[model samples]
Target: MLNLVDSRSVIKIIPYELIMDTVNEHSCHRPKPTVVTISDLLATTNNDDLRFALLYDPPSVVLHQCGGSGCCQSKSETCTHSEHEELFLEIAYLSDPDYVKKTYLLAWNHTACKCAAKNNNRVL
Candidate 1:
């Protein structure tokens, strides 16, 4: 049972399955599986959708650094591309069954440098 407080006057008790079903319905828009890690939840294609999702369900945010690569050079001191790539890599790593079970967050940070390099190429 999950108690959801929509507003001061509106409170509803919902079953876990119903909540998961709603999530699944929303996730069905994407071709990928419904079960997603924190990283995947953060990497939504639509910024508004991502913001809404995060607003409702806050994820465990992780800070990632740009690894001294000129790929993400821009006027801004902070590199948005590098952060996107890191989140993508974290999601990719979490998708792997071998590492997912051990600890998704742990595997995200511990994966080899090659994985990050491979994922970096895919990100814009």
Candidate 2:
């Protein structure tokens, strides 16, 4: 323990209360989370916007093999969407934002989808 004594020289001091009171409400806001669940996607529907988004900003081919829903998919297999659908899925990303696309890319089979592949392409 140290005892306080009057200093010979007067120095400027900032009040602790003043410093603490200056807290901004936004700064105190809850931090954003890093991980998320497909339940967020469950709120959406039969992939209209998802398709539009993919049509707008195509993602890298690196994530092409991703199982979209991140579900029971094999090493190089994807779930049912039709090649056009899959391409749209690969391109469409179930019609959501890139973050949604990323979520879709890494998500599991959120829904019970049929398993198949179609070698078809479409004009987007």
Question: Could you list the CA RMSD of all candidates, in the order they appear?
Answer: 19.5, 19.2
Q: Residues 65-122, candidate 1, lDDT per residue (tens digit)?
A: 2332222223332222222322332222223323332122221221211113333343
Q: What shift in Å separates residue 65 of candidate 2 from its native position after superposition?
A: 27
| Candidate 2 Cα lDDT to native | 0.33
Each prediction's Cα lDDT score?
A: 0.34, 0.33
TM-score of 1: 0.19
Model 1 weakest lDDT span, ten residues long: 106-115
Cα lDDT, model 2, residue 71: 31
